[model samples]
Target: MKSNTPRMPGRPKRQDQDMPVQETVLFTASRLFMELGYEAVSLQQIAKACGVTKASIYYYFDGKPQLFTASVSAVLERARTSTSQILVQPLPLRERLIKVSEAKLARSHGDFETILREARSSLSQKQLDEITSKEEMIHDCLAEHLIKAMDAGEIRRTDPLLTAHAFSAVLMLGIREIAKGTPADKLARDIVDLFWDGLSIR
Candidate 1:
């Protein structure tokens, strides 16, 4: 089995001296975006959640566009961290891939997924570009591991990027059903089984 190594991300952006305040705003925005949708979530509403004034939010971010982007990006970073931990373990390629999918499925239930579906209406072109790049980095990480496994013959040889996207798509679909009362463990296991068996078939 090919052992995959985790890639360390670039240096963290230094948090503002007022990081606690920015984090609170981000927290409030993330939850509200999930519940209310981005269009319905006003700066005043976010301020109310953070126990601050709308001006305070503006001091941290230009507007709702940046707020939503920062909030969802935080969640994606968390998911990326979880995936990094999963990849570092000495496991078979298939098992490592399954674990990565399950980690992402857990994250899918959070506010970011809702924000992702809704943020396009609220974010600016710059904000959209930044968030898209962050998400694309995560996809690239998965594709990298797949390529390594394929080269080592630990899994079927396939288009690495396409397989990575397919793996992500299946997990996202499974997570949507899992959110609606299908047990997460059962759904994850069944999805892994389907992927494994399908790969095994000629």
Candidate 2:
């Protein structure tokens, strides 16, 4: 006669067990790439950070170029989603622009200039084009919203594409202010006030 017995749970599952290895690698690689720049980071470093092997990384990505592109793409996708949400708010155009600027500044942590410069050497032309295309999509999204605001007479009529580019540049500059310990709310207001003073239709 056999006695019925409940099987004990094996080792407790790790909190990250539910996450796929590829996703883990992507996230870890993105942080490393941002912190260390593209050329300075390596698959071995990422693998160790993710608690996996270099071969495991290769299983998910072809090489460093592919991983770097994927990591940057992940960041852009997140920024796109956040920008979309901010743009869709029912706030006034100026307020929406401020919020968007704040969001962009909040997300700008990496040494982007280094990443972009280094990526050109490591990434293929197609990969470089893809990155540029993603950037253009963000610009185009802003431009589309600017065009709508102009049509509504909420702001002065201007070249939406050029205006969008200018707005993005100004917001990028705000990152320096953030580094200087200026509050994001204050920076946002200052940026919007300065931009509106010039762009607003009296």
Best by TM-score: 2
Query: Given candidate 2, what's the lDDT at residue 121?
Result: 84
Misplaced by over 4 Å in model 1 are 1-19, 108-117
Q: Give the TM-score of candidate 2.
A: 0.86
Clashing pairs in 1: none
Q: Tell me the spans in candidate 2 whose CA falls farther than 4 Å from its real position.
A: 1-16
Instruction: Give per-model CA RMSD.
Output: 11.1, 6.0
State the weakest 10-residue window (summed lDDT) of model 2: 6-15
**Most lDDT-accurate candidate:** 2
lDDT of 1: 0.72
What does candidate 2's lDDT look like per residue over 84-134, in tens digits?
A: 889989999888988988887775475565578977887899998888787
Give each model's clash number. Answer: 0, 0
- C-alpha TM-scores of all predictions: 0.79, 0.86
